[model samples]
Each structure stands twice: as structure tokens, then as C-alpha cells.
Target chain A: MPDHPFLLEAKGLSRHFGNNIAVNDVSFSIKQGEVLGFLGPNGAGKSTTMKMLSGNLAPDKGQILINGIDLLDKPAEAKACIGYLPETPPLYKEQTVSEFLRFCAKLNNIPKKQRITAVDNAIERCGLSDVSQRLIGHLSKGFQQRVGIAQAIIHEPAVVILDEPTSGLDPIQIREIRQLIREIANQHSVILSTHILPEVDMLCDRVQIISEGQLLFIDTIETLHEYMQSSALLLRFDTEISVQQLNAIDHILQSERLADNTYRVTFAPQHDPTQAILSKSLVEQWQLTMLMPEKHSMEDVFMKILREER
Target chain B: MLTISQNELQRLFLSPLAWIILALSQLLLAYLFLTHMDYFNALQGKMSAIPGAPGVTELIAMPLLSNTGMICLLITPLLTMRTIAEERRNENLPLLISAPISIYKIVIGKFIGTLSFFLCLIVMTLLMVMSITLGSSLDWLQVLSGTLGLVLLVASFSVIGIYLSSLFKQPTVAAISSFALLFLLWIIDWASTNAAEFTLLSWLSLLRHFQPMVQGQMNSQDVAYFLIIIFAFLLLTIRRLDRERLD
Candidate 1:
């Protein structure tokens, strides 16, 4: 973890509805000005966790600290620093976009003199100025989602928690919203929950994967990639080389032919297969063009972690 | 609280449901008044033949108040059915729940908005009272008392409707349940033969207490009964909203 102060901390948080546990003993922390991607499949307790953090659903088992304040013990103080947008945008259909934001500002206790300016700032930030006067029911899904973000940030809280912020948007809208999230993250710590793997890879600095109410991993995306690294070497040769000749190298555990004259070889991590191949090539008077190590993608790491947990 | 009230009032007026209710109630009230005028004219012609007959004006006001009270019972469910039920149905309750405003303020704000519309309907019916005064020696005091009683009775029914609205998640279910509950209360009073032993039911019956007021007698006990019913149901609504949010 960086030296930055932690903005959010959860310890042994759990929620049970009757006999079934919705979120079981999940714990993680996010730091100041950090973007933490909360990754989980459907019904995997992502929304339940977000709800608890936002004060919408109280936890049945442990403690959540927002800016070092316990949420359960001092709910208003804790919530004063957090903003939340649930999976479904809770909007009054009859209310115009501007009207809704104004009400949210009042609900958030924005000072009377600053309420209009704050609402205007949010409208511009969320790109909702065009449809500000339109009734929420008349707007499309994308515009409605923008309105949701507008309400969440109208209060200018310290942390913004969004559950599936880009769930239903098209590619263009997704990109726009991602940019908006990035911009918002500049000023507030964002806890974004999403099922899209690529979104986490593209936007979040760190990710927490939760499955069946259990937190499987919490690490930076870079470390997660390193954790999934495979012990393989990719080689490209200008001249043709027989598979049998490449197999002659002692460190070559397995070899697969690629296009033209290239080959990929898998070996043990400490083996340094490139030196072995180069020495064999020098001995055989054959040319070796390129030799490089292969790195794993986040998708590979995610699948590997999930598979291991299962 | 003021913002919540203004927002609620704006939403209440913007919907077609509110207008549909007001227009239908006004039409019903006009029909009842025209019918009452005709009946009173016929009764006045026969007043000399009947021994110690009450004046047509006095006879007309009681049924008019009863009819108007019954009409309010029908109209209130329509007014309040969507107040809380539609919010939950559309998943919009969180907007109010997460706000700093208390549940009581939200419920009361909505109640006041609906009551204002109901008051407009009462004002429209005052035209009928004006017509009665132009043709006959009608007691203006009786008219004021009757209108006051009708307003209180309508306000009480609106409270019950709002309370029931908060209990159900679907607008249709809320509307149907409120109508059924109010209809049952109306029938219980209609079927009871003894008014003394059923005094509790009489007090509960909005029509029962409204009768003396429509006849120009302002009974403090009756006024207190209506106020109690209003307070009871509004409190129940607040509690219901709180319980839902907690769960």
C-alpha cells in the first residue's frame, strides 16, 4: 500500500438475511485519492457490500470506518463523507433533472447559497446540462445514468461509491462515463463495483475480486498481472528451424510452432531458456532473431484466481 | 422540509392522476347538487300538506352533506393510492429515505398536498350553496359547519388512504385495499341498528359525526373524533414508512 492515508476500511463485514449470508466476512481498505475496482459476478455480494458502505444496508457482523470514523457508531458522520449510486438509479420520474439534483443538494445539506452553483457544477461535470430541464422519465438510459452520477456527487463527498456505473451503456457512453469516473476520482476516492473485467483493467489501479461473499484477492493490477506470469519464452527467427532442433535445447520443456519460422517455448522460471537456445544456435551455426519473455494479462489472472478458489 | 413539500406538490400536480380525480369528483358533486335542488323544490311544494314538516332547505342540506361525504370517500383513495406505493414500485423511495428529512415530514408533506387538492374540490361545491341561498332562506352558518365537517371527514379519509398506500408496494394493490377498507367501514355503520352500543363505530364513521354538523350543530366531540382519526392514521403512515426503510 502507498503511504497515503486510508479513506475507507472494512473489517470482518458481513450481512445475513435470515439463514442465508449475503456478504460473509469481507474486508478491504481503500486509500485517499485512490480508485478501487470492486469486481464480482452477479449475486456475488458486490451490491450488498456497496450498500453497506453507503449506509443503505447496515452490516450484520463487523465494522466499517470512513476516514477513521466507525460507520455503525456514527452513521451520519460517516455517511457525510460518502456518496453512493446504487445499481438501479433511484430517480423520481416526474421530477426534472435539475429539480432532482436541487433536492439532492438540499438532502445532502449543501448550503443554501451554494446549492444552485453546486448543482450547476454537477450538471456540467456529468454532461447533463443539455437535458437539465427534461423530466427523468423522458430521458434515455444513458442520460438517466448521468443524472444518477449527478446526484451522487452533488454533495461533493470525500468518497463516491458506484455499483455498476456503466452497466447498460453503449461503448461510446461507456467511454464517456469512464472518463467522467476518472475525472471524479481526481477529487474523490472512488469505489467502483463492476462485473466487466476490461473496465477494471483499463480504469482501476487496484482491484478486489469477491465471489460467494468471500474476498479472494486484493492487489494492484500490476501485481495481479505479475502473479499470473507464466514461465514461457517467445522466440522469432528469420530463418527456418526444425522443431526437433529447438527441442535439442535441455531447458525446453515444451515447444509450439508459430507463423512462418517463429516458436514459443515453455520452461521452468529460473532456467533462462533464451541463453540455452542462443548457445544451441551458436553451436549449430543457425541465426536466432528475437527472444522475449511472455507476460500474463489481467483476464488470465482473474480466471486463475477464481479457478483456484473454486 | 419545505423543499420536500414543494417537490411533492410539484409531482402531485404534474401527474394526470390528480387531475382525473379532481375532474371526476367535481362532476359527481355537481350532479349531487342538481339532484338535491330538484328534490328540495318538490318537497317545498308538499310542505303545507305534511304536518310539521321541516323546511326544504334543512332537509336538503343533510343528504347533500352525506352524499358529498360519500363522494369524498370514493375520491380519496384515487388521490392517495400512488403517493407512497408508486415511489416504492419505481424504486424511488431511496431518494427520500437517504435524505436528511425525517419520514414524518415526508408523509405529512404529501398529506398536505393531497388535502389542498381536496380543499379545492370543497371550494367548488360552495357554488352549490350559493345557488341554494339565491332561491331559498338557507342558513349560511349551517353551510359553513357542513363544509367544515366535510373537509375534516375528507381529510380523515385521505389520511387512511395514505396510510394504506404506505403499506403496499404496488399502486393497484394500494388503491384496491384502501377502497375495500373504506367500503367495509361504511357498511359496518349502515348495518348497525343501535347507534348507542355501536357508539365507537359511530365515532369511527365519518358520516355519523358529519351529520350533526351538516344540520348546523357543531359538536366538539365530533370534531375531536375526526382530529383523532387524522392523527392516528398519519402517525401510522409515518411508522410504516420508517419500518420499510429500516428493513
Candidate 2:
């Protein structure tokens, strides 16, 4: 509504429960059509932040602007532009999927005439067309989660915030939900909070890493991939190589023998020693069975970021 | 607000609890109505010997309406306990919380939803009263005044039930506390020795104000009392939910 590039922006948000600070001075923004993955561990304040952003929980201090409207000042108007799904899908298990979504459409103040189409669109988008007439209690957990998503997007707000949308689903369901989220990102900006790290890489255009209520990292997924690009190499030789021989290469930080004739070689980020190692191995007659740069799994980068924060 | 009220009412009917409460209350009240009618018919000759004797309206309808108050106090908690507490327990509250609506609208919507269901029960009781008009000449003013008193009494009880429901997460706990509080309010005036005193406790008693209207007397003070009680408790419920969001 205003002249802002970000559809949703949270600034210096903080919430406290007694002596515990649940979310501490966090700030970030997401542009339209971008999926901002919120990565965090349990109790890292991801849910708390999501609650504050969606206007469900008011922060002790901070401002949340949805489409440049202040959330605390004009909550109903600002919240009209935002959609939220908490950690547990907030649903009435007694109602059928279409019925629940129609109720949501009413809650969001959609015009009566358009409500049917809005509900139908949400049902179709969430892959819930098959079971729209079934009671939510009778559906599987996966279907219920889809109903949660449907209720969130029923009014087609500018921002859709889903907290742990895929936490308890099986692999197949998880993949299906991810695909659905990817489809949602085509029209609305999405802020998805999940502890699962790979989900961020798979669906997010940008990522924010939070740990202990602190924003440790906020960057594009490419930069996160850069973090995953470890400066380590794995090598296997026909004959066992001495640690001293591996250390002799320039820019090699450290080297460790993992098994017979196998070594994990750490090197500096600016200098890769693969070419040096190959020439040296040839001169020393160390028959190279394998040579490849070691890549850090998402878990490694996640843990490394968390460890550095501590 | 209408949207929330409609959804809440639909959800209430969807559960077996609402239908059970409706059927059980009608059964008990109908039985009470028949017994009172039989007693009035048996005493008809003895009452005619006395000058200006009470008729079916005085003998049957007033007492039946008074007893309806007691039934309402007992059953309203059961009906209203699930209004907010179950939503909180099942984590369904966030859907309402995150919507683009004020907390006041939500509280009032829940109150209206529960009040509408109770209105149906009162209507059923009025139907029973209307049946007596077929056999004898009935005092329409007395019956109407009694119905007004019953409506006000049930309305206040519903407000209390909804307020307690918002305060607790477990529906059973909410139901129990609501019954305890309503019963205390219902009989609090008994502690007063004389009606002439008109102490604060008696003024606050729910039954004290409801009694005059049941006797075919309509006073502005009695109606104001019930209205004030409903407003105050609804305000308390709105405040509770606002505080819950901050918490």
C-alpha cells in the first residue's frame, strides 16, 4: 500500500517472559515473491518472532510494518495484509476443510460474493481439493496441515508466515508441502520458519539464521551456499601418506588421517591446495586413488554458525 | 463480529454436547411444567373458595419460571464452558487471534452465540406456558413478566459462564468454577436478615432482582441490574483476552 519494497518488515522486535528473553532485538524484511526461510533450533525464538510478526503476540518493544502500516498502531488493518500458521496447525477438527476455510475467509473480511472463489482457490492451491468435504479430524496429519495452510492463504494476503509447516510430516508429505509452498511463493511473500536446515536451501530465496533469540545471519541462499563451501579436501592414496607430507603443501591448514591411505586436508579459504597436492603426490609417487574438495552438509554449516554464536 | 458468532454457533451445534444440553434441559423443564400443572388442577376447588385467589398463572407459571432460573444456573456453565477454554486447549485460538478483528468483537461474538442458544431454550419454556392458555383464562401480563425475568436471569448467567470460560484453559475447570460462582451469586442475598436493609450483598444477588419481575412486577431497576452485570463481565472477558495476548 505504501512505497516500500518489503511487503513485511520487523524492526528491533523483542519479547520477554519474566526473566527470559524470548526474542531479542531482531530485525529483518522480505520482498514480495521471495521466500525468506527462518532457520533456528528449538527454543531459539523462531515461533516467538513469528507470533510477533503476525500480530498474534505483541512485542515488548519493536515495530512491525505490513505494507508500511504499523501493526501495533493499527493491528486489524496491518494484520489484514498478513497470514499466519503457528507451530501447531490452529484448526477446528470438527469442521470440514471447505467449511473451515470459508470461516477463515469471513474472518479476513473477504466480500461475501468472493468468499466461495477465495476458499476454492485456497483449497486448490494447497492440494486439498480431494478432501475438502471431509471433517478435519478424520484426515491424516498431512491433510490437516494442508487445511492449516488453506486457512492462512484463504484471503490471499500480501505475506504468509508459516511456522514449522513441515515439522511432523513423513518424507513424501514434506516434499508435497514444500512444493505447495514453492507455488505459494509465486504470488505472495513467504516467511517460513523451520528447524530443518535443508528445507531452507530447497525453497528459500533468502535465509535468516537465529540462535538463542539472536539473529546470527541474514543473507541470500547463495551466500549460505558459500558457507557450505568448506575449504577442506578429501584424498585417498594407494599408500598411506604421512601427516608431515600433507602439511608440506602451501596454504594447507591441517591434515588428519581418517583411515588407511585416507586423509582429510584442511586448507585456507583463499588458497586451494588441490593443484599443489596433485604435483607433490606425483613427485612422491603417492598414487592418488581419490581427490575432491570436501563440502559441508547444511547441518555442518548450521552447527558451525550456532557454535560461533555461542 | 457476526462472522465469529455464526462460526461459533455452527461449531456448537456440530458437537454432541450442545444437542445433549438442549435435549436434556427441555426434558427436565417439560417434566417440571407438567407436575406444576397437575398440582394446580388438584387445588382448583380449594383456591376458588378464597377471595381473590391465585389462578393457574400465579400457581403454575410463576413457580415454573422461577425453577427455570435454577435450571439455567446449572446448565449454562456446561454450555458456555467450551466457548473459549476448548479453543485455547486445542490451540485453535490463534486462528481468531491472528485474524483482522478486535478482541472485543471476539468476546461479544462468543457471548451472542451462547446467548442465542439459551434463547431457544427460553422459547421452549414459553411454549409450555402458552399451552396452559388453551384450558383456562391465563393472566398474560403475569406470564410475560415471568418470561422477561427468566430471560434476564439466563442472560446474566450466560455472561458469567462465558467470562469464566475465558479465564481457564480446561473446560471442566471452567465449568466447575462457573457453577461455584453463579451459585454463590444466586443465594448471596439469603445472608441478609431483612429486605428493608437492602444491603450491598443483596443488591448484588442475582436472584434478588429477578424475584420482583417473576411476581408480575416490571421495574426499571431490576432490568438495569441484569444489563449492568452483562456489560461488566463482558468487559472483564475482553480485558482477559487482551492480557492473554500480551502474555
Instruction: Assess the local accuracy of residue A68 in candidate 2 as a C-alpha lDDT between 0 and 100.
Output: 92
Q: Give the per-residue lDDT digits (tens) of candidate 1, residues A1-310.
A: 2243678999999988777788999989988888999998898999989988877777878899888888777766777778888888999888899988998998777999999999999999999989999999999888899899989888888789999999988998899889999999998899999999889887888999998889998989887766767898888887788888788788888888987878989987777777778887888777778888887766777788999888
Tens-digit per-residue lDDT, A127-210, candidate 2: 898999999999999999999998888888999999999989999999999999999999999999999999999999999999
Question: Each model's TM-score, in the order given?
Answer: 0.88, 0.95
Q: How large a fraction of the reference contact set does each model reproduce?
A: 0.36, 0.92
Q: Which pairs of residues collide in model 2?
A: none
Show the colliding residue pairs in model 1.
none
lDDT of 2 by residue, B101-190 (tens): 999999999988888888888888888888887988789988888898888888899899999999999999999999999999988999
Model 1 chain A: weakest 10-residue lDDT segment is A1-10
Model 2 ranges with Cα > 4 A deviation: A238-254, A275-288, B195-197
Output the chain A TM-score of model 2.
0.93
DockQ, every prediction: 0.46, 0.83
